[model samples]
Target: MSPIKNPTTFFAYIRRAPFGGRLTQGQIDGVNAILDAWEYFKLTDHRWLANILAQVFHETGGRILPVRETFASTDKAAIANLEKAWKAGKLSSVKTPYWREGWFGRGQIQITHKANYLKLGQRLGVDLVKNPAKTLDPVIGARIAIVGMAEGLFTGKKLGDFFSHNTDDPVGARAIVNGSNKAKLIATYHKAFLDAIEAARGAVDAADALPEAAIADDVKPAESSTVMSLLGGTVGTAGMSALLGVNNPWGFGIAALVLLLGAGAGYMFLSGRWSVNRIKGHA
Candidate 1:
């Protein structure tokens, strides 16, 4: 059996190498809640989880972008205009002279480009072009990213199905994400996705076994008591009496004497004669 079948081992994998970076307690809780929701939504595959993590890590250096004050003012209208520029090809000039062009693609997963943000925001019930900072929230970012991954850029094809369909097409969506070395990146992402699935399966199996395990634990004491009673009945009725005679008669006698003395004192107290004499003398 794979160690991943064990919940403890599976959680150890998560604790050692969680997707996001330097998560606070609250962030970790949020991440766990997201994972639970994903499981509830039947998205429990480790590969998908890891892919999301890698995408976010690659985009935002694993740090959540400040909501209102990272690249510019958190103005919804301004963000919408930026998207309009990207779709119009007016903002194609890499004026910043860095890796990518503009600064609007700022978040955990970097929801870049204006059109994508508008689409994702609409699906996630947020005004992405306006409150771009909402994408920095891990839960919102993960949900939007998942939606985008499942549903392509304004296309109806699921991203996974699309990649599989265009595995041989050099200019496909996969190629756009990974560039010239798209095959290698796709393979890596695919592996991460598979790992996430296996981990999630293990977690489910472990959860299913929990009730049975609890029942077994509860039954153990009863079994132990039965065995003890049998042993005691046999021993007390047979060889134990003989062994007690030989083991230390004097010590047993001393214990009996101590017990008798304790009983005699208790009897005297119960009789209440001393207490009665004191009470009568005081009166």
Candidate 2:
């Protein structure tokens, strides 16, 4: 979770592939809010961040913001829509109409049920039970989405349960929000968001545990002396082939090239550019 220096780069990378090349201020704001929360919380896990973004996209239907369960414009409308669905038998798995009790799904995490509101509210140090709509705020919603998944407050299954250094189970990570419902779909979103986040890196992360070599873009050309040595070697090899009774010119030349330049590059001509490290690798 290193802080990305430029968010615009992130937007640029995922614009066409994941975000479809069209961006709205609301979409940008929603994503930025989540990124801000990630930085503010001092979180360092990219998988956790990516999985959180996936959940946001899934819960908000790519709005990247909080909304009611039915995506209705108003609480009244959301409740009414739920009731309509309930009566129509569309909600076969629902035991009761949770929205009627004023605890319909809200926020990027979309916590439903009254108990979750109270629990998540207490953890967030806010009275969400009293003011449930407050969860609609992007700041609050992002925090809830990030923290809840991190701490396993949603369904007692955490991000760690599915993601770690050795394992990345985006499909299983659906346990952090709901059950295994739509786990594969959410996994697809997770990979997309994760790829975007990685591509968005503007600087080397302090916590990144990778060894790197700084190769100059413009490799230096070989010197005249070096060119003469290679030319001399080729001419010497050709003459030696004849002297040593090597009848086939192609076989002798190929063998010479393989032995002289074989492992990495054998030998490079002066006309080509070269790097010290590349030469070392060849050696």
* lDDT (C-alpha) at residue 150 in model 2: 93
Residue 189 lDDT (model 1): 40
lDDT tens digits, residue span 1-283, model 2: 5555534345544444456655555676788789989987899888888889888888898889898888999999999999999999999999978899889999987999999999989998999999999999999999999889999998899988888888889999998888988889988888878876876575432232111101111221121221223334444555433323422333433543454454234334343555455334553
Best by lDDT: 2
Candidate 1 lDDT, tens digit per residue, 73-184?
5555446656666667876764442212333554444555667678888877788777666776766765765666555543443446533533422124343234333445
- The parts of candidate 1 lying over 4 Å away from their true place are 1-7, 14-47, 62-103, 154-158, 162-193, 196-200, 203-283
lDDT of each: 0.44, 0.72
Clashing pairs in 2: 1-44, 261-266
